[model samples]
Target: MTAASRPVALITGATRGIGRAIASELARTHHVIIGGRSRAAVDAVVAELGDASAFVADLAELSSIADRAAMLPELDVLVHSAGLIGPHEPIAEVNVDDLLQVFTVNVAAVHELTRITLPGLRARSGSVITINSGSGFTSHPNSSVYSASKFALRAWSDALRDEERAHGVRVTSIHPGRVATDMQQELRAMEGGEYREDDYLTPAAVAQAVRLAVETPRGGNIDELQIRPQ
Candidate 1:
């Protein structure tokens, strides 16, 4: 198919990890656009995938998200892979900075980007995918801020799916257990925990799950996907 005939896929925090893997998978079948905070990383990924490009985006900064979104064209898929891990503490004793940053990226970013992208997606009957976590589904210790943001994201995705069903924009949220990526490592280190790599999932595996949701046949959708490492 020509450029216009191929579907457009946009992914955030795609400089590395699950986002990177997902971009590679989609680039095989669609025109992929990756959003990240690093210019060199974005250019590098774009070099590998001829049909893929990148936009400098910082989910923690709404202005950056807006600037990046303004330069992007309409996309058939929007994957929210950006997230933040907050300070390790109990619900009542959490750090305010951690809470603010986590909520800004995880919940607010999702809300703003979707609000802007929904119209374009609806016009094409596209798809919106958000990366969630198992923590959002159940309670966890020392991660109250992170869990809260994801919980908000989960609820937002559900409402988004319901509202856009008639417009043909399918909204999906994915919940995956510990993944063997830098995000996992950073969060574990922040929590003062050492998780076995063998017990964690790989970024590629999660990317496959995302691809399945995006590539589903017409008139059907994978509303929610929860992947656990066993």
Candidate 2:
């Protein structure tokens, strides 16, 4: 397909890790739009993908989302890959500011972006992919805050899936376990555990799951995909 006719995919947090892997994978079939907080990082990925472009904005800054979403009048796929893993601590000691920060980026931002882009997605009968985590289903001892955000994200995705089905739009939530990304590295550090790269799932593996969800036949939809390392 020619450039103008190709499907458009916008992947937030596309600067590195799972987001970058997803952008690269989709670039082969779609004109990828890389989204991230750093213009340089997004541009570098765009340069590497060749057929891709950049959308630089901080998801934490919710007010900027509307204008950024405006720039994309047509979007075939929206991937909510950007997230924040706030300080892992017990709920008793968690600061309100940190809780708000985590929820604002992980839940609120995702909702706003999806809301703004629903029309474009519905127009094309497109898909929305949420790069969720195992925490959404099961929260650990000191992971209450981060896990809460993921749980909320999962709930939103579930609600959106049913709400938009009649509109011919597909919504999917992908829950990946222990991916070997920078986030995992930081998580390991926080827990004072050894960083074992080989023991974790690769970013590309998670990206492939996303591709499958986005490419599923029109009549059928993948509500959620749970991926874990054997």
Candidate 3:
């Protein structure tokens, strides 16, 4: 099929892990735009994906998003996978800078991206999927900052779903537990424990959930999907 005829999907954080997996899955039939902060990393993933392009922009820098958004003529699927897991510390010990940084990327960026892409999404009745975390539902000790950001993300997705449903845009929030990614390694290291891949969900598993939501019937919307490791 010609590129113009194929649907376009933009996946942030496509440099590695779950984002990369989702990009790969969508590239089977869609024109994938691999979004990442690092040009080198984005280029490498695009090279490996064969039928994909690169979108290098820092989500924390809101100004850059508009510039990148202008380059997208039309978008059929938007997957928000870029996020930051800030320093794990007690609520009383949380630094204000860390909180701001985490929220900037996790919540603020997602909001802006969704806003900027709404028109394109509406034109095609596209799908908006945010890769949320299980922490969005429940918090744990020393996870306040990350959980707060995710909780805010979930709220945004919920509101967006309600507001955009009238315009034919489907918004979904996928909450996955303990994905086996570099971020998981960092979390385990912070707790002075071993990182066991066997105990965590694979990135491909989360990608499958994204594919399912994106490929749902035209009149159906999978608003929220929660995947936990058994």
Best by TM-score: 2
Q: Each prediction's Cα RMSD?
A: 2.1, 1.8, 1.7
Candidate 3 clash figure, as a count: 0
Question: lDDT of each model, Cα atoms only?
Answer: 0.87, 0.93, 0.92
Leading candidate by lDDT: 2
- Expressed as tens digits, the lDDT of each residue in 1-230 for candidate 2 is 22246899999999999999999999999999899999889989999999888788899999888888887857899999999999888889999999999999999999999999899899999999999999999999989999999999999999999999999999999999999999999999999999999999999999999999998999999999999987
lDDT of 3: 0.92
CA deviation > 4 Å runs, candidate 3: 1-3
- Candidate 1 per-residue lDDT, tens place, 16-65, comes to 98898888888899888878888899989999888887777778889877
- Lowest lDDT 10-residue stretch of candidate 2: 1-10
Runs in model 2 deviating more than 4 A are 1-3
How does each model score on TM-score? Answer: 0.94, 0.98, 0.97
Task: Estimate, for each residue in 183-210, the C-alpha lDDT of model 3 and write its tens digit.
Answer: 9999999888999899999999999999
